[model samples]
Target chain A: MATTTVRLPRVLEPAVGAVREVTVSGATVQEALADLCAQHPTLTVRLFDEAGELRRHVLCIHNAQATRLTQPEPLADGDELAILPAVSGGSGDGRFEHRR
Target chain B: MTTLAVGTDKGAWLLHSDDQRSWAVDGPLFPGWGVTAFGRAADGTYLAATGSGWFGPGVHRSPDLHAWDQVAAGPAFGDSGPRLEQIWTFTTSLDGRVFCGVAEAGVFVSDDHGVTWEPLRAFNGHPTRAAWQPGAGGMCAHRVLLDGDRMWVAASAIGVFRSDDAGATFVPRNDGVEGAVPDGEPGIGYCVHAVVADPANADVIWRQDHKGVYRTDDGGDSWERIERGLPAGFGFPIARDDASGALFVVPLAADENRVPVDGRFAAWRSLDGGDSWSVAGKGWPDEPTYTSVLRGAIATDGDGGVYLGSTGGELWATADAGDTWQRLPGRYPRIATVALV
Candidate 1:
């Protein structure tokens, strides 16, 4: 089993013990995320969209390499994955911003 | 103990004030996330619905209103259907059940004091949803008014929906409400910004629509335009103090321009159930203003304690209906919603 360290965005710190670094075990990026979600169950809903797919705005970085939720490359032992959300404006104070 | 809970784009804060003149603030709890809605459960559990651009949406539960624990299994739309974007408003029923209105226009109920939630499928699967177009605020179920088995839900760009069987099934009740969409027309596409139900008489309901203000005496089966004594019609937030039978509304310029009416900031109130209105503008700044108060930003605590948060990040409190106002210290992120806990 490959042991990887995951980096989550600062915004997610409160849900995941306020830790910037989390050690997870997995051989692939998907597996690492599964382990990470297992460790922090509440993080599952935030990380995945309703289709059980990674949200379009979230970025999953694997050892300095960008990866998509649909297709994740293999991860090696001691790999570092960064999970962060795409930068965007606030959800509009309930007005002004157009909703999809 | 009157504690003002402010939900902002960045996080949530608690302002504890004994005299309503001075406040001791606490917060920024979910630091990087947006706090869309807040409420205190019937059991005294404080709940804040938070959403992150990166992490999605969840509920933060607190027993003492200070320290909170994020609950992961709050509400979800399975792996299909419309995505649950944000938790727009939270309503705690008289019996302690918590109901949360969410973006994508749906309702979820939590029996365990917001620890977990399940969708009200009947309302979500209503036939009108096919024609439910999103307003500028997205297709959000922003307001849920409950009175025993009868429940009413208001969504932006959608008219009021009523559920007589305890939210099991809902039917559109937009008889007198006007629609803003072209071919989309009336019924489902009518833009309703906010709604408040009379605590003394559940049959009486009021709405702040994109076009004008309306009141329904027969429980939303029909409505009557009640724009008397108002500067302009377009407004976002409308609330009422059940104890005193006083109604509150904030009128804006118009749909084309949503700033305060004529650059003045004031809340229009009606003591005799929307028959007429008077400006409750004491203690408010007379300077030209351009701020907008969102639908969920205005809340009434007990008899006449009115608390409002503006898009400009200012918190205003009025202890005596709107006779006078006091501004809370410090400016924070854009305010989305407010509640008295």
Candidate 2:
């Protein structure tokens, strides 16, 4: 069993209502994510693409360095992984709606 | 509901849209930096380039498309080399590699998502880095459109460059292009504003230069001028829809204005690739109000949505390939880059 810590941002910390950390397992990154999404069903659609595949845009980091989903990269015990979204240049006009 | 991640002067905003065009927004993330560029990866995540007005630049990411975090930060104006900097453009390849086009500097790639980065040394190392001159907006690496494994980047005065090895090295792609000759030479200046490869074809490509619109069927080896239907081919931005192979361009009515009829917006649509075109002003702005769309700011959402963000902070989107238009509310924060998220 591999144990890793996942972190959420402030905006999402609220949407998810409360900040909660969960554990997941598997040899591949996808397998680990599958377990995580299973525990936090709210993250299923955002964590994968239309085909339900994992992409780097989701920015899954294993132990500080980025992880390759295709490789047989294994997670270490007590290691930490981050599931981050790709942030691009954007702005908020006091006029439009702001969700998160 | 997919949110349209709009980068503007004030900050980063999310224009979220449901099935009925009922759009909502989230965040002006990084409150200070005016967002300049951003791209949502196939995995449905978003990456943003926060413009730090006078402070600096930084890159942020959100895996869930909602929450964002600053993974990396850039420099300020007097900071490209000696000072901090700003990221002019940000995009991700279908394969998920992140590329950021910076000012004064060149392209930077972050292979491990956006946690850390390595400058596209090949671009920053271009022999002409120092010699290359910035246009009206500074030497911002404009567009980094990825076609297959190859990548294309635009540098003002440095022209357009192609890297088949994925940002490793770059070579010029400016043959047969004309217009930006400084009123003398037959060649267009190295100031390329935007470039896009036909989503359906690897060989065909198009770019917007300071002088004229260009096309290349030989990867980036050679190009041809396609200025027959434009008031000025010396426009700044270009866009395309991968589904219909339909291309759309907004040429500034005047060489200097780049803001046709005084910012009265007009969209030029090319049907048979770039071989032919027709103008559509149904949803565009009217002239005399006087303004222009920014470089790399015109694009389609892949599902028939075409949008352009202007320096005026206006954002307009059309659902039917320019057939009709709808006005969204409000305006952009700063108006550097706009993308469908």
Candidate 3:
């Protein structure tokens, strides 16, 4: 069994938990996320949308290589995954703006 | 039985008060999720429409408002259709059919009281899909009103639509409303921010749109400008006092800046329907305040209480029909909607 470390950004830590890192076993990136979701069920909703797709604002990087929840790459033992929110300059122009 | 459900970007809260003065706040249900809208069923079941930056939209049903069970069946699209982005409104008809309006502009119904949802294909696959483009908030069907066999649905940037045979077929009803459309744009579809049907007269409907305030007396067959007494033309959250036929609206400055006019917070109210309006700002902050109220952030309890939630995370309540207001206790995430029960 391969053990991987998953780290959530500080902004999202409050939504899931204060703990930044969690370890899960998997041979591939998808397997690691499935195991991570099983260990922390609440994180599933925080990390993915209802369609089980990664939220639009969420970006995940695996072992320093950016990976999408829609298309995950394989993982290796001791690999690290980091999750962060997409950056944007919000506006109050009252013109319709995309939020999500 | 005076209860308020405040749906926020972070979670959902239930505020209860017996005399409309002291309130007891409960929960951050589905913590860290955005609760876009919620409603109470006839059998006292509370259904919350929630989504998040990491997760998409889903419905959570609560029997006692204390414990919630996420429903297995939620809004979904077929393999090739646009996905359901967010659940913008949850409503129950007199006949007990629960209806949910979602982004990508579609309606869904649950005859089993939120247990399962099926798309109202007539509205979803309407022939006007090509011309109905999304507004700033995306193509969302946010408001649903039912009167007998007649129903009204509001889709942003697409104007108002009416269905006489109960969601089977629909036709556009934007005869006199205005949109932010560019010059020479064909069709009359406009951005409708919020809409409320008259409790006493189903045919009388008031709307707060992207450009102005309007009223339709002929059940949306046509509409007329009703901003004669409003301070500004752009704002969200239009609610009505059911018992007295009084209407309320929060007016922001303009399309360029979506804050209250002059940086002051106030709610404009009309006693005799929409003939005229008066500003109500008593008990609000005197200092400069810059915040906008979203489409569903305002609600009336029908007795006398008027409640509004601001994007600034403040909850304001008026006990005597907007004559005076009081800021509620806590600081919450941006509020999406407030429901009074």
Can you write out model 3's per-residue Cα lDDT over B115-182, one digit (the tens) per residue? Answer: 88898988888898877787667888889999988999998878788999998898888778876676
lDDT of each: 0.82, 0.64, 0.79
| Number of colliding residue pairs in each model | 2, 54, 5
Model 1 residue runs over 4 Å out of place are A88-100, B183-186
Off by over 4 Å in 3: A1-54, A57-66, A69-100, B183-188
Which wins on DockQ, candidate 2 or candidate 3? 3
TM-score of chain B of 3: 0.97
TM-score (chain A only) for the predictions, listed in order:
0.82, 0.68, 0.78
List interface RMSDs for the candidates, in order.
Answer: 3.9, 15.6, 6.2
Task: Flag the better candidate by lDDT, 1 or 3.
Answer: 1
Error of 1 at B232 (Å): 0.8
Order the numbered candidates by TM-score, best leading.
1, 3, 2
Per-prediction TM-score to the true structure, in the order listed: 0.95, 0.71, 0.84
Calculate DockQ per candidate and list them: 0.52, 0.02, 0.20
How well does model 1 score by local distance difference test? Answer: 0.82
